[model samples]
Target: MGLDAFAAACCAIPVLASLLAVRFAYVLCRSGLPPTRPRAAGLRCLIVLGSGGHTAEMMNIITELQKDRFTPRYYVAALTDSMSLQKAQVYEKSLIQGEGEKIIKNAQFMQIYRSREVGQSYITSIATTLLAVLHALWLIIRIRPQVIFCNGPGTCIPLCASAFLLKVLGLGWSSIFYIESIARVKKLSLSGLLLYKLRISDQFFVQWTQLQQKYPRAQYAGRLM
Candidate 1:
């Protein structure tokens, strides 16, 4: 209320912010995922899982891969209409509003959805995952991607399943990364998960310590940005 009080409060703000950031980082680092071994071969095609913000990140990676040597095409396994799905990607003409925002994207892919009216994320994720399985299977038969990389937005289960099946026969991507969105900090709700097996890929990425511990076979080794 007074000048001295105001000055003290202002001084504490930075300290509070620093403390929060430290806690966030600790949560991330403490997350326990299985150690991932790097692949011995070069990457080829890619299969992306989910949509929204995380999907965009995978697309950015695909664009970079295309420019280099990998012939990258993506199968987007998530909820979206074909047209709106097109809009979901970052365009070359997209101008960013701030420094950290991405403005350009490149990756041609297909989308498989759960539902638009569904409000329960758990159910929706399972449905999307199953749909993604069918879609990815079809793509694998056709394009036969060398690698299937999933950028997570809860639709990782099916894509990875498809890849695992492909790998069983020795015809799929060598590494799979489940890049966590800021929203994927989930507590364990189910006892034995029917989904979230995540056993296919050579690498798995997550930002939550709880999930990291739950799935002790995944690698908590990287960030998306």
Candidate 2:
């Protein structure tokens, strides 16, 4: 076979495998994802961790979480870029006016990062990841919240890691990753890969049907805007 033909054959196998896995995952999620509603009553705190548009959605969920019987204690924000922080600030008044959900912004060097592109972004990302882990560990130690909710930024890496550790030690609260999109081009996203690897979030609420096929573990939540 010619060189081009050989390359096509090699690529074809992985593509076919990916397709099969997608099909298998679709069948799995068609049954539905694991139950995510807080099993216990009186959830002391619900940390809404996201900055941009995702943060808006998180805020909505935070509202949902607060509506429950418990009466929330804090709304910890580890914001990403400045824009996200601005978006978060807009909700500051709403957060305070209610049952005293403290809107504390704890953005360490690692929790917030920006660069033009990939390349060394990975190296900085690692630093960012380490800092986030330390921040998470420290927060979990200090706040001792019943749950750490995530609408990922690079900041989430450490928090998720620390929360997972806490759970193992039998001292941690619940950690959740609010998966906004199921079919994002993974090869193009550092955060997405991190979410997949950490895998700590209790449930992944997928917003698309095609995505459910790609991520078999994800629970299809239907379409998102």
lDDT of each: 0.53, 0.54
**Highest TM-score scorer:** 2
Please, what are the lDDT tens digits per residue for candidate 2 over residues 110-171? 23322222355676676755665666688667666655565555555566566656655547
Q: After superposition, how far is residue 38 of candidate 2 from its true place, in Å?
A: 8.8
Candidate that would win on lDDT: 2
What candidate 1 gets wrong by more than 4 Å, as runs, is 1-42, 56-66, 75-107, 113-132, 171-174, 186-198, 208-215, 222-225
* TM-scores, one per candidate: 0.53, 0.59
Point out the worst 10-residue segment of candidate 2 by lDDT: 107-116
Q: lDDT by residue for model 1 over 68-144, one digit each (tens)?
A: 33444455655553533464344422433453655333345566544333475776666755665687577566666
Displacement of residue 167 (Cα, Å) in model 2 is 0.7
What C-alpha lDDT does candidate 1 achieve relative to the native structure?
Answer: 0.53
Cα lDDT for residue 164, model 1? 54
lDDT at position 155, candidate 2: 59
Model 2 lDDT at residue 122: 74
